[model samples]
Every structure is written in structure tokens, then in C-alpha cells.
Target: MKEGAKLIHTSRIPVRWGDMDAYGHVNNTVYFRYFEQARCEWIEQMGFPVSPREAAGPVIINASCTFFVPVNYPATLVIRMHAGEPGRSSVMTWYELFVEGQDKLYAEGAAKIVWMDNATGRSVPLPEAIRALFDAAAG
Candidate 1:
């Protein structure tokens, strides 16, 4: 895969009416939600043998997005998900957002994720299965 082309999962999100702020643009917070959708979808695609109950316990250590063109209602938002650089006990999720049917980039960025033992709430090395997910998805 080319740099910035390692898409492990992708989806088109329909712009929601409520995503627009009073200024008639998608609010800054909506970018985070869009990135969340990409990450969740990628996790599901990895077939990690997880149920919703088991998946709820991860931490977002960091996240940010850079905006360019604006997206509006009734439009399709294309989201691409890929793995980022990993450390001893954490990983990053990178997202590239585009306007559907066009190459216009609306925004792009990443979130730092750390896995924790559910009971202890302490950071842990990502499990082997999850590591495989990164090996397959890392750009």
C-alpha cells in the first residue's frame, strides 16, 4: 500500500442535520464522532471475537483533526481508517475524511488509543489478536 493508503476499513456517512452548527457548518465535535465511526468499524472488521460488552473499555489518550473543505447536509462523507504508529502499550488510529463522489478532503487526523485491563484499569500491551489488526492495517 502507498503511504496514507492503508485503509483497513471504510464507510460513507450521511451528513446528519444535527451535525450542523448555527453557522451552517459541521461542528468541530462532529469530526471526532466521524473518526469514532471509522475506528469502531475497523475494530469490527478485524473479527477479534469481541462482543459489545467486551469492547466498551478502551481509552482515548489523544485525538485531533485538521479541517479543509466544509461538508454539508445531504452529502455522503467518506471515511477511511488505518493504523498509526504503535508504542510499547499504545496505538494510534488515523482517519482520512473526504467528500463522497469527490476527492475533496474535509479533514484528516488521528486518535491515540491505549488498551487497559478491564479490572485493573492499567495500560497493557495490546493483545496478539489486536496486534494482528495493526499489522494488517498499519500504513
Candidate 2:
């Protein structure tokens, strides 16, 4: 974890057989899905709607991942989620992926989430509840 990065959630996801490609390893795109699962869990647990059709909600501006080792099926993955300091309307979330029972890092990822008005498709200030969560994590 980076300095000042607060771990907010963790998830264990099983690697599915279909996650593998012809290369016999988990497909590169699947790594992002794993990250998304962990991130979504965190958001939902925070009492935020995963998808809001008419109200302000969160949307990803950008996302990225770095694969250090290829993961295979028959494995349970532990994904640790971290949050950086919040901005007015955005926050940077980080993730580290590891196979269960292993200390090695399989991948690391990040996504910048911005609060947006669903009706107007415009950025809006993050909800106070979210800012309070960051503040609690920081302390």
C-alpha cells in the first residue's frame, strides 16, 4: 500500500475456468474484472448504489492494471482494496491481487472514480458520507 493509502475492503474471488484463454493463463482482461468485483463490493458496502439511474453516483474515469504473474484456475484470489485521499469529486482506489495462501502479488490495479449526476452526466461533489469514510480511514 502507498503512504496514506487506507485499506477499505478485501474480497476473495475464485478463478473461473472460462477466465483462461488459449494461452492457458487467465486472460489479461479478466484481471480487470477481478479488480472491479472488489471495488464494487466496497462501494456497495458503503451504502452507495452500484448503479443510479436518476441520482448522483460514482463512475470510473480511468482504470489500469499491472500483471506480475499469471493466475490459473483452481485458485482463490484475495483482493485487497485501498483508498487514497478524496478530492472534491473524485477518489483514487487501489487494489492488490494475490492467490490465497501465497504472499506473491499477482497483479496491482487502480481506478479513479468521480461522483456524477446521472441525469446530466456531469461531475458533482462526492457525497458527505463518502468523505466521512475517508476521514475515518485516515484517522
Candidate 3:
């Protein structure tokens, strides 16, 4: 996280009725669901290398989240995500949530994931193909 970074994907989440808490506001955990969807969309859009028996090769090494404003249920939430430049064997994913049609930023967060060798269970540098995908995604 640096300031003024470029974002890759944006996903709109319609807050479900069940997302509410007793106080009539969207539950805190619900925000993470938005983050998950945003990340999934980014990966899907990249169309990285895939094999029939192989899966996406990485594990989240760290994650942190912060909330600035509260959003009530029955509203639409917009989550924007970006993958930062690759460093060693990892990539940093940044996120921000906006409520009320981009009028307000409710939260900002990040997750760091290390490219990994699934068979060996070790962190590995991102493959060149996947790195290119991220570069393209950054645009």
C-alpha cells in the first residue's frame, strides 16, 4: 500500500437481507465476503495458467482490514481491488469498499499472497505467464 495506486477489478455486491445485524446495519463479516468476491473476479479475469488437475497455486500469507463507515443492509456495495507489483514470490492485493454508488468509501484493506508450489508446499516466484497477467490486470 501506497497512495494513488491503480485498481484492477471492481465488483458490486447487493447487500442481502441476511447480511444485517440486529442494529439494522450490515454485519462486519459481510464486508469480507465482498473482498472474497472481488479477488475471485480478478483471478477469473486474468485467466492464468490452469491444468485439469491443478488448482490456483498460492495461499494468503497475511490479511488486514479496516472500516471507516457503516453500511446498512438492502444497499448495494461496490468493492474495488488491485494487485500490486510482484515482489519476490508474492503479490499484494488492495481493496476499498464504497457504498451509495461510489459516494462514500466505507473501508479499505489488503491481503498478501505468496505464489506457492502446491505439491511441495512452499512459496515460489510467480510464473512469468501469471506475472504478465497481473501486469495486464493492473491496467
TM-score of each: 0.83, 0.96, 0.83
Tens-place lDDT per residue, model 2, 1-139, is 5687898999999999999999999999999899889988988898887887549888899999999999998899999999999999999999999999999999999999999999999999999999999887777
- Residue 51 error for model 1, in Å? 7.2
TM-score of 2: 0.96
Poorly placed runs, candidate 2 (over 4 Å) = none
lDDT against the true structure, each candidate: 0.75, 0.91, 0.77
User: Residue 61 error for model 3, in Å?
Assistant: 1.4
Best by TM-score: 2
RMSD of 3: 2.8
Which lDDT tens digits does candidate 3 get at residues 82-135?
777788788888898988556777998898867777777778787687677667
Query: How many backbone clashes does every candidate have?
Result: 0, 0, 0
| Displacement of the residue 128 alpha carbon in candidate 1, Å | 0.7
